[model samples]
Target: MYGEGDNQVKALDEVSLSVNQGEFVLIVGSSGSGKSTLLNMIGLLDRPTNGTIKIDGVNTTTLNDDKISAFRNTKLGFIFQFSNLLTDLTVLENVLLPRQIGGTTKTANKDATDLLKAVGLESQINKRANKISGGQAQRAAIARGLVNKPSIVLADEPTGNLDSVTSETIVQLMKSMAKRLGQTFVIVTHDRQHFGEVDKVITIKDGKAFEGEDDPSTASGKEMEVVA
Candidate 1:
């Protein structure tokens, strides 16, 4: 709801959904749809006006501001449409930023290194974020998102600015991470070609959510796997 009385606008109405642990879920909708809004809520960037949000069986809607911040730092990961890497930081440093803020930098160093390597950006770890290619930068962002060993990663249009090949690469990387680490992923994307790789797709239309079925004819490419 955006306003009061006659001006009220309900972005989402009676929407309820859930994702199983380690599941790769996609949320698809058009622009101006409530997909982004739903992502924000799940990522703890915004709170719902009504209804409870439970993460890992804990009710997050009841947490205070300080506790919510703590939960976000320790339990959730976020990837946005843009990489949003800090311009002044090196790739490794950007990936380390979250841990530094959470006061776990010293212990999480090796984990950060492994994550960057997993994303194929290990060689570019020392480069300034601005010096990296767009795909490389996005990979760094992925590393940052995983550094905390979060249970769930919430990505909002992570591939929106990339080429088809790069988008496939990014999605594959996320899928690989989920399988290897048993981490859950909830992504909002408009592309349908990658649907076959995910366990489920939830569609949002006019503020309502429905179980989405992917047609085999609409799916493209073989499901990607991480190479050893």
Candidate 2:
């Protein structure tokens, strides 16, 4: 539905693609290339003005806000640049926050503890979220994301605020869990230095996506049959 009007921003144009249930997807592009908009749509935080978005075989635009929120609570996870962990809560408490929104806050303590341990933040569980370092806080956020056991994890520049070493460490850690849990991940990032090992990279420019491994000046791979 993106064509010709002033209100129309071609955030995603002719972008037809599908990501598998257990794959790691890297979305790379410089700023204003619709990377954030694409992630938001994929994460169910925003709806596209045109085009269909399906997650797990269900088109998301048809779902109402409450249904969408409930679906996301159970089927998707999110990690972002800022941890967004509550300052008044402890690490464990922050990890348990999603449960509150999903109305399962009563017995989620055990699950929160497990997720915290999984993210290597067991020792920091009792510490206030605000007291942790940026890296540690992001780890706690990771724990929070997994608390609901979503099938897919969407991260928008998850390491944007950290040093190179910490960023590398955190990315690997998150990927390890994503692999072990058999969950899908859509990562939107500008850090080209960490591209070699990515499973797949899709580059977007002026709202159109160039599929396959990230290659500029080469033919776009969109016409090729995508396996997933």
Against the true structure, whose lDDT is highest?
1
Give the alpha carbon lDDT tens digit for every residue of 14-125 in model 2.
6666787888888887798888888888888888786678888888889999999998998998999988988998998888878988988766999899888888888999
Of candidate 2, the 10-residue stretch with the lowest lDDT total is 219-228
Please report the TM-score between candidate 1 and the true structure: 0.91
C-alpha lDDT (0 to 100) for residue 126 of candidate 2: 99
CA lDDT of every candidate: 0.83, 0.81
Clash list (residue pairs), candidate 1: none
TM-score of each: 0.91, 0.91
The list of candidate 1 runs beyond 4 A from truth reads: 214-228
- Candidate 1, 8: how far from true, in Å? 1.3
TM-score attained by model 2: 0.91
